[model samples]
Target chain A: MKKNKSDLIRYLFFLSAILSIALIILISFFLFKEGTVIFKEVGFLNFILGKDWSPTNTPSSFGILPMILGSLYITLIAILIGGPVGIITAVFLVYYTKDKHYRFLKSIINLMAGIPSIIYGFFGMVVLVPAVRYLFPSNGNSILTAGILLSIMILPTVINLSEVAIRAVPRFYYEGALALGSSKERSIFKVVLPAAKSGVISSLILGIGRAVGETMAVVMVAGNQPRMPKGIFKGARTLTTNIVMEMSYASGVHRNALIGTAVVLFMIILIINLVFTIFKERNVNG
Target chain B: MSKIKIKDFNLFYDNFQGLKNINMNIEENKITAFIGPSGCGKSSLLKSINRMNDLVDSCVTNGNIYFDDKDIMKTDVTQLRKEIGMVFQNPNPFPMSIYNNIAYGPRTHGIKSKEELDKIVESSLRKAALYDEVKDSIHKSALKLSGGQQQRLCIARALAIEPEVLLLDEPTSALDPISTLKIEELLQSLKDDYTIVIVTHNMQQALRISDNTGFFLNGELIEFNETDKLFTFPENEKTENYITGRFG
Candidate 1:
């Protein structure tokens, strides 16, 4: 009877693992099927690298370079603003804060992450957009606003991941460093951070992925003018926002073209995830 | 002489007292070992010197600890720590290359030239008796070395910083018999320059290596005596029972 029960438990775990893989495969298959139809009609190369993106008109062109460039621009801004702050916050929490305060601060960060994405977008629309307008009054619904809002949206993720990474480094590392007559900052930078390199990189990558895939918030604040952002204050559209904005009004070739944009967005995320995995693996082996 | 003086020291972990009023003096250029069963505050006393106990969330200390006549509690902890090096029970090498592991300390102290750092790294490794084995591959990841080699490398790292005092918490507790002997020899040689204070569980190690030994039991210093006398003629019954394996 005990043997049978143990066998059942093992089978259940095995089934769960198989189910997860199957779910990923299923999602990939549907995405590819929906995505490839557009690529087949329009050459994949042209769909990827073309410059113009007017879906409604006759001379209809869906060169998505502007959207890609816009996404890259906003993501870079968010990283610049958010990455250092997140890492510093994590360091403060791990190395400096007392236990009670650490827990309190940690809970606040967790609550920030738990707040709904749309709620953050709504908050950005209400608060940050106007704040940006006030600061840069000449440019309304600009890329700068989108970047700042997205940086706020992803701050919790960066902080949470960085905290976990820093905390995961064994206590022995700190003790060893201290014993060797290293100052707390020296130990953190020279020993702790280096050991947690993989975790830090993954956190940054996760932040980038979050910034890249963000649509609703960017749309609300970005002024969605389907152009490459020339300045931080200039309005722009990203791949996800372009898809969301056009999908309802799009029909036939236009629909396919919009879906093709989704496919491109999907590929970009895939490439990001691939690079993340490759970097992690290289660090492990290297 | 760079002696460590602890006068009327007591320690507390939050509300619970961990160590009682203790007075001890560790002489310069000598290997002093603290021995006791677990939870007896052997490690606590070692940490007090470098102010490592300050990092503990609820830890608090009372009384004065002096190294080289400077009141440790009042001294700049960062500067004090930089002068007194420590090695833990387990060998922990940073995830960097062996060269960087030794050079990290000197670099932090503002030795920036690569050529100068290379020389420092070589000399430190030689002092730790690890140079010959790892000289060719100092750039390799330190994590790849064996447990014993890692421990020695940690010692080299501490030595590289040129600390006046070396506090070792069971430096050979994790090593094999051969490695332990090698470390004992290394410690003996190191006594010419460093004020060595070690905490050990192995009575044999304390007997073999230390110039002075302090036997602690249940947060009290039961006896502090010359190494030879402590082994042969302990004044306290508890110390005698402990050395004779009556009960720990």
Candidate 2:
């Protein structure tokens, strides 16, 4: 009787694994089916190259160049501002900070990670957007404001990933460097940082992805105009914001265009993940 | 006489005393081996010289440690560490090309030019006797090397900084007989330039490589003398007993 029960449990486990694979395959098929329409109707080149993005206008232009530019702009700013600070904070937590404070700070960072994305956006909206508008009214509802807000939204991800990466470095690596008479900072930058390069890079890529896809929070603060950003203090819209703003009340061509935007975002995320996987594999094999 | 001096140095880890009121002097440019049973605090005493114990958060120390006429505790730690290098019981090479592993220390101390780094790496590896075997593949990852070569690479890394003192905490404990012999031979050659202090559990190693030796028992320095004299005629009965396979 016991043997039969054990066999049943084993078969159930196998069934769950098969079901998980089936679900992923189904999702991929759906994405391909929706995205294939673009190749047939608009052609990939026109969809990618055409810059006009006024879908609700009389003629209904649907080029995504502006939104793509906005996405790139916001992602770039977030990475530029967040990358160094995140890495340094992680290094401090792992290598330099006193042990008594480690646990307390680590838990606070963990809490930041656990908080919902919407909450971060709300905080950014209520606090940062208004503050920027008050201080620099001429730059109100600008790309700079959105970028700064998104940097905060993604700070937890960068800091958490970087901390884990730095901590994951084998204790012996630090000891070995110290034993060689290298200063702590030198060891961190030269040895620990290089060894954790893949992890740090992945963290940066993750932050970029989050910034690119961020919708509701960015919408509330980024002055969503679906136009190319002129500078740090200009309004903009990303592929994600374009979809969220129009998807609820769209029909026919407009819906397809928004779905097309989603497909592009999906591809961007896919490429980032693929690059990370390749680098990590190379690091392991070497 | 005071090449490395410790006066009433007591070390503790989280309220547990690791070494109690330890006092000793290590001569200059000589090989001093510390031997004892497990947990006798030999390694603790060796680590105190360079303040490596500071890496441990709960490690608290009382009393003085002086090296070369300066109290090491009060010196700039980074400068002090640059002058005093260390090796461990287990070999740990940086996860990089073998050449980079040797070049890391000198490069950190402002040796920027590639040609200069390359020369230092080569000389350090040759000194550790690992250059010839790896000359063709210096750019290859160090993790691919054998255990003995990795240990030697670590030694070469320490040597690249040109430290005055080299502290080894059972450096050969993780190696086989042949590798251990190679390291002992390397130590003999190295003692000409650097003051070497080794902590080992092996009585044979102390007798073989060290000029002077100290024996510890329960955090206490039982005896300190020249290796030959200590082995042939120990001043303390405990030292004689510990050396001759008596109670540890």
Candidate 3:
């Protein structure tokens, strides 16, 4: 009787484990099924590479090159702003911070992760927009604003993961460096940091994923201009923002184009995760 | 010449006494080995020389540990460590290339020129008896090396800074017999230039490579004498029992 009950529990646990994988396969299958319809209507190359993205014109053209570029630029800028700050904060938390302060700081970081995306968007709209407008001459709703907002949004992910990675490094490396007469800071930066290199890289990749997939905050801060991003100061439209901005009222080919844009975003995230997996595998093997 | 002097030294982790009041003098350019059963303060005493015990949050020390004439507790810790290097029981080469691992100490001390660093790396590796084995694969990750090679690389890393004293904590306990013998031989060669202090569970290891052997029991130094005399004719009953393969 005990063996049978245990076997049943084991089977249930296996089913629960497989359910997530099955859901992912099903979701991807449906996404591809729906997303490919637009490619049939417009050539795949044209859909992906064309620059003009007018969905409501007399003869609507669906080119998402601008949106793709906007997403790339915004994500790159966000990583630039957030990556170093997050990593430094992580180092401070792991190595330098005293035990009493560590708990307080850790709670605040956890709170940052728990805050909602919509709240972050609202914060950008109310505070960041006015601040940027005052600092710079432009209308403030630009790629720079979006990048800054996204940078803030991605901080929790970057800092938390980097901290964990840094902590996961074996204590021996730090001891080894210290025993060789290296200062605490030197030991951490040179030896401990290198030992946790793959984990840090993985954290950055995850941060990039968070930045790319973010939609609500980017929409509120970015002016949603569907043109090539002129510069850091100019407004832009990301693939995510493009889909969310028109998904409510878009029809026919317009709707399919948005879904197609979703496919592109999905592909970008997939590639990022693939890179993360490769890095993780290399860390394990080498 | 005495390389280090411990005067009424006592160590505690929180309220638990780790090392009892101890007094000893270690000579320069000689290998001193501390042997005892597990958790008997052999390693604790070894770590005390270079102040590695400072890493433990609750660890407290009383009295003096003098390196040369300067008290180690008062001297700048980084400077003290540079003067007194250490090798752990487990080989802990940095997760970097073997060449970089050797250069880390010099780099920390502000040697930036590539030629100087290269010379230091070669000479340090040679001193650890690891240069010929790792010369061609200098750029390879130290983690890729065998257990013994990695331990030797760690020794090379410690030697790179030209420390006056080297503290080793059971450095060969994790190695096979051949690797253990190789390390013992390396330590033998190393003692001419460095004051070597080692902690080992192996009585044979202590007898073979050490000039002076200190037998510890329950956080106390039971015996300290020349290795030849101590192993062959122990003054203390506990030391004799331990060396005779009786209860530790």
Residue B248 lDDT (model 3): 70
Compute the lDDT for candidate 2: 0.85
Cα lDDT tens digits for candidate 2, A56-83: 8998777888888888888887888888
Q: lDDT per residue, candidate 2, B28-109, as tens digits? A: 8999999999999999888888888888888999989898879988998777878988888898999999988888888778
Candidate 1: tens digits of C-alpha lDDT, residues B137-212: 9999999999899999999999998999999999888999998898999999999999999999999999999999
Query: Interface RMSD, all models, one decimal each?
Result: 1.4, 1.3, 0.5
Please, what are the lDDT tens digits per residue for candidate 3 over residues B1-248? 99999999999999899889889999999999999899999999989889898998899999899999899999999999999999999999888899999999999999999999999999999999999998999998888999999999999999999999999999999999999999999999989999999999999899899999999998999999999999999999999998998977
lDDT of each: 0.88, 0.85, 0.93
Error of model 2, residue A129, in angstroms = 2.3
Give me the runs in candidate 2 sitting further than 4 Å from their true place.
A98-100, A134-137
Candidate 1 residues A1-286, lDDT tens each?
9999999999999999999999989977878888788788768878777777776668777778889899999999998888988988999998888878988998999898888778888888898888887877545688888888888888888898888888988889887777666778888988899888887887888899999999887888888888656788889889899989988888888888777787788888998888788766755564
Residue ranges of candidate 1 with Cα displaced over 4 Å: A1-23, A279-286
Model 1 scores a TM of 0.94
Question: How many clashing pairs in candidate 1?
Answer: 2
